[model samples]
Target: MNVSFLRRNRLLAGLFTAVLATGIVAGTAAPASAGNSHHKKIDYVALGDSYAAGQGGGRYLDECLHTKAAYPRAVDKLPGVKLIADATCSGATSLDVLKHQIPRVKHKLQKAELVTLTVGANDIASQEIRETCGAPGAAAPATFDEQRCTTLVLKAIANVKERVLKALVKIDDIRDRVKILVTGYPRLFAAPADAFQARANAAVDGLNAALHQAVKKANMWGVRAYFVDVTRAFHGRLIGDRFPWLHAEGNDTWHPNKWGHLAYSVVVIWHVKRIF
Candidate 1:
């Protein structure tokens, strides 16, 4: 072997060893957080519905509707993360979070450095129209019945807004230092040109708009809350993305799949890094 070649190999080996040693030392010496004693370890309290729970996504834990790739689980993989991922069963509306999740969270919030919430879809009243009115061969609402569907749409939006506002109020009791991230829903229906489809999508958008408004109101009250808009994030990929996260009629398709969860994780982490 050429003498210079042998010397080059030795130099490369030494460099690799040095890098490995540095990584180990850094891992051991450094706390996961950036020197904030209060955030030495990330204590996350996750709240919300199926998306937060990682529904329909791949790699669910125990194959229960909740998947391992859910945003909370993804965040858990980050260095120094300690997560209390308590997103409940699917179909949980904002009211459920306030009446149930908030009470259960009081204990965790005492020490939590992060709190993330994803909700509002279940609060929408259009669930019945989507379930009952849109079925195959279901009688089209008579010209007279169109008003009924419209009525349901408006009622659901109003109720969802009310629930979202109440949840915002309850959020104030959580810890001050904890960064609260409120997430809006992704569009389940792709953008459509048909008049009826357009109207239906509008109802869904209304619910999401309410969610955004609620988060803003909470922020005004001095909660460290921010909203992650995922409405257009999945545009054009709904059908092409084999694992559609939208709940199919009757199945728990309303929740997110693994891919959908991953997308949400990206948005959440993007904002979360800003403060923490």
Candidate 2:
């Protein structure tokens, strides 16, 4: 009846159809990954922030903002992968992964053959994204009122470096040989719609650079770690695209919609198959 309700219903239906189709493919004919000797499933543990937690996708599984559409669940659907635990939460920072989420999943870490980390955004620029962006998706204000937001976000990233290392080391210590994939964030929009959008996109670039550095540092620490570039997840689908993968309403603004989650899942899955 109402516009919002109608749009909501349409989105939900689309998500349900997509997930169901994915399930069918997984259940009926998912192929084994190349490295697996006999289609042995890789035990995986996913950790990070809202991106990994599957926020703003379809439906919430818990307060952490996990949804069935998250990359971990999607990865699990592959014939050669099995999800052990998803110790991620919405709004989690790198330190939160180190001090809170990781501790709870120690045992899970022990058994995980693969672990993926998608954090650090919250630790650095979340405030600027939320307050400066004046949006729920943790982006710069719609009004672009904060000229200094980008600078602040860039400066804040330095703090997350050590925290990311700590989290990586902790995971490595727990699962000595487990392949660690620290994923980078995608640009929220395909192109810069304006100065604010351009700055916001640049902030994401800064975040990705920080993540890449953290991965390298983790390797120096003797951790079997790698950085995953996820920018391509939104290659042709951005805020102004005809088929944008991210939502644009209420608290979902700028967060990945189901299609965006699917794209993220594909990128992550590709890295897993190639690297792990």
- Number of the top candidate by lDDT? 2
Off by over 4 Å in 2: 1-41, 128-151
Candidate 2 versus truth, CA RMSD in Å, comes to 6.2
Clashes of 1: 9
Kindly list the per-residue Cα lDDT of model 2 for residues 1-276, writing each as its tens digit. 558645744664566455534432342333335234245457889999999999988889899989988989877765566788889899898878888889999999998888999998786556645576554344435466565665567666776777888888889899887889988887876767676677768778888898889889889889988888877656666787666778756776778888778777766776666664
- lDDT of all the models against the reference? 0.64, 0.76
The TM-score of candidate 2 is 0.79
Tens-digit lDDT track of model 1 for 59-90: 55643367776777666545445686575556
For each candidate, give its TM-score against the true structure. Answer: 0.74, 0.79
Q: Candidate 2's C-alpha lDDT?
A: 0.76
